[model samples]
Target: MNWKDIPGLDGVESPGLLIDADAVQQNIDRMIEIVGGPDHVDRLFPHVKTHKIPEITRMQVDAGITKFKAATLSEAQMAATAGAREVLIAHQLVGPKVDRLATLIDDFPNTQFAVLVDDPHAADAINQKCGDAENPLDAYIDIDCGMHRTGILLGNPSDALRAHLDSLSGLRYAGLHVYDGHLHDPDLQVRTEKVKEILGKVARHEQQHPSPRVIVGGSPTFGIWAAETSWHCSPGTTLLWDFGYGNAHPDLPMTVAAALISRVISKPGEGKICIDLGHKSISAEMPLEKRFQFPDLPDAQPIGQSEEHLVLQTPNAASLHVGDIVIAIPRHICPTVALHSHATVVRGGRVTGERWRVTARDR
Candidate 1:
């Protein structure tokens, strides 16, 4: 559907988030096409963390997506209730959340649930919680790819842990979960090579134990994953391309679905422009390159940020006046989306409708 068809574009309040429905749908279509168009063999479990809105998730479901990759138990439950048949909790379910985990399993009987774990203690906890049940919980051993954030270290010794989990009756080994956030690095060749290396290791592991399926891939690496002859890819960011990926792969069909629609709150002195959205809205974690594809407008750089303000410096500061809405694309889509509660659907420079509650925001 086009943006003009949406309900409240022209009247949307300034400093709110706007999601281009056309762009978002295109992002979903492009990612599905890149991943072999959602046949049973090839699964596209979008990480709900990128766009937590259940409406967006429903948009994907309407397009024939049944599985989802969630970052937390709450997201999984939300997705399941929204008609997502399979939910993979990409993060480890540990700490004191055993009751929460059990609650999810009991609540979503029709839904297939899985979680990732790098520690035996976590596996033991999950196994203990779901062990005697008629249905066992699926568990994927997260392997540490190039990024050291999560996952078990890849290679020889990790196989022992997998074997131990295999002995547990309450837990069924699902597969390997590898998130290549490090591959989102600007260097194209470096990212490609890293993904290839990680996938190769995963393939070798699969050759040894073929029961649990191998799932790998993230938003930035989705295109690179399309050419893979083996392994499954879980791509989330493609659903909502941000400034960082847009700068890297401009040719990709996905558009900036979520933009911080901020008005020029302040324009003090030469070459400086301030907006109402700051670290609280758009994330400052991802760095921006000085160069940009958009013409006329100077490279927007985040010089400083506070709770409710983004301090940016641009060359054409004189061209921008206070009260003009500047659509600022975020560097990273996940955290940036988590900061906002609703996104206005816009088309042709006007707000069309409102999509409330990006469902997967919390936990």
Candidate 2:
């Protein structure tokens, strides 16, 4: 089935997110299969940052995925409300976020929410705000394996930081949070070796002080981390596969579950057409040509884009007319999903009249 085609797409609006419900379920099942099987679902803590909708979170919970990783307090709340057994706010908390997290914990008693801390002072701040909560707040020490983005170096210094966390009176030292998002080598062997090297350092640190639970990997190195039976895996973009990860890692055979629904607005010139999918509709982080892919018009070249319009030069533009539906798969689905408040659901080649709200799009 060409999951991109929507049989009853006329009812759907342009410049909005279109989600294939069946494809999303297929992706969920495939993720469970990749991490072993239903019995091994515990090893999968898929990140909820990709699709912030609570309905998708509920689908994962129904698939036996208990834990989830989130990037914001709102996302954590959405997961907890969606019946997630545990939710980890991967970002460190400061200022009003600390208190907001405390409230979230209090509100969601059934869900155990955790946060990341890379410094001792930050740990103290978290404790001060959440120490007296009904449930003991779970905290993970963010360790930098290789990506110098936002973690403490993995060595004696990380050991010392863990010691400081363990000493905190209110916070429970959950484990280590190592996110190697920067590692995305196309060669599986090369990527696997680099992951093993990072884990080797982690294993050495565990020799003296072992972490109770270790969460590692993003969508790029999810397969590598899944092999390590002891650690948990967190892969976000795999839920809604995009051109960015799909093109880079061909080994991961996940389905593209979401696409941008656009319509041709005009025939500007010879072999040139305009669409409403500007930077606002799709994620513009990648290069102009790399931002989106037209499955039907494979040769469509994005010549120009602005806040409200995207001009493309396609050989088939002469055959196309205004109001023709055009579907595009975004290079980065995560941020594109955030641009819309809701997404129209498509199943069995037709619109299901169901819209999943991007409930956690705000900060």
Candidate 3:
């Protein structure tokens, strides 16, 4: 679709992922400013999996942000190649993936790389692979602060494990990696309390070791660490705010940066309209209301969704027909961004005739 040709957004076409460049830049600036100032941009090890685009990473690098966090080897390689001084593979690598990670470090000797480790066996695999490459790997202790998804439990004798890893060859202790993925309470006070309680646990763990560079926060609880000079905050989604957090945390000093520009396709029935936006177009993990927000059609409700069809029922259904375009703010912008191969760039209320590729997708 020729997005630039359309004078009005209604003609931009269906299932189009439109990204606001101005808003993204604003977000980048605010993020840097929040965690101290532009001078302290290096303190943020931003997770790049949210918007898997090289353009975004380069924007950050150009603005003097050095450190980055990634979920997969592909993202780590992308960040390193994009001129990041340090890249942290926030997710653990095991078996053959360990060597691939080691090779990434070998491939880009200029860029320092580290991975998170919760298990000694996984650490052994990574260290052995790095040993084969005549290099010692840096590793962070993944401490579970509440999110049981990954990382070692805080009470699992993590200090002993930390001691054991320090003795192992071909590996250096980077720091403690604490991700409170579960601390996203809508109430700022509640979130703040939860953050302090969990971060206190992280602090105690650090006291035992004395100096493990603590990396914490996800988009929600970043404010807790924003003023904290010692803590390296890793807030990825804050770079591109979504409705999921935005709707909940109205007090979070950030704007809705990314959006999905989808056009209406068919009127399935009375008061029901079917848009081309399927579950594939945006993130379907959250509930209906939390998945997407429609500013144009306030009453628009996602009644059903499939691969290529999004059935909606709204009070203003009669106002929209086939080919009428609408803007949707995804509740979860991360997966929605990953859904598109490229984002149609818009600036000053006009298409810039450029596309930002979603580089490290599904890897």
* Structural similarity to truth (TM-score) of each candidate: 0.87, 0.97, 0.93
**Candidate 1 versus the native: TM-score?**
0.87
List the global CA lDDT of all models. 0.73, 0.89, 0.81
Query: Which prediction has more favorable TM-score, 1 or 2?
Result: 2
RMSD of 2: 1.3
List model 1 lDDT by residue over 155-202, tens digit each: 664677788788888887787787787766667677778878877777
lDDT, candidate 2, residue 113? 83
Sorted on lDDT, highest at the top, how do the candidates line up?
2, 3, 1
Off by over 4 Å in 1: 1-10, 38-41, 185-187, 250-252, 270-273, 286-296, 299-303, 311-321, 347-350
Error of 3 at 204 (Å): 3.1
> Candidate 3: worst 10 consecutive residues by lDDT?
1-10
Clashes of 2: 0
**Residue 314 error for model 3, in Å?**
2.2
Measured on C-alpha atoms, candidate 2 has an lDDT of 0.89
lDDT of 2 by residue, 235-339 (tens): 999988998889889999898889988999988999999999999999998999999999989999999999989999999999999998888989999999999
Candidate with more favorable, higher lDDT: 2 or 3: 2
Clashes found in each candidate (C-alpha, N, C closer than 3 A):
11, 0, 0
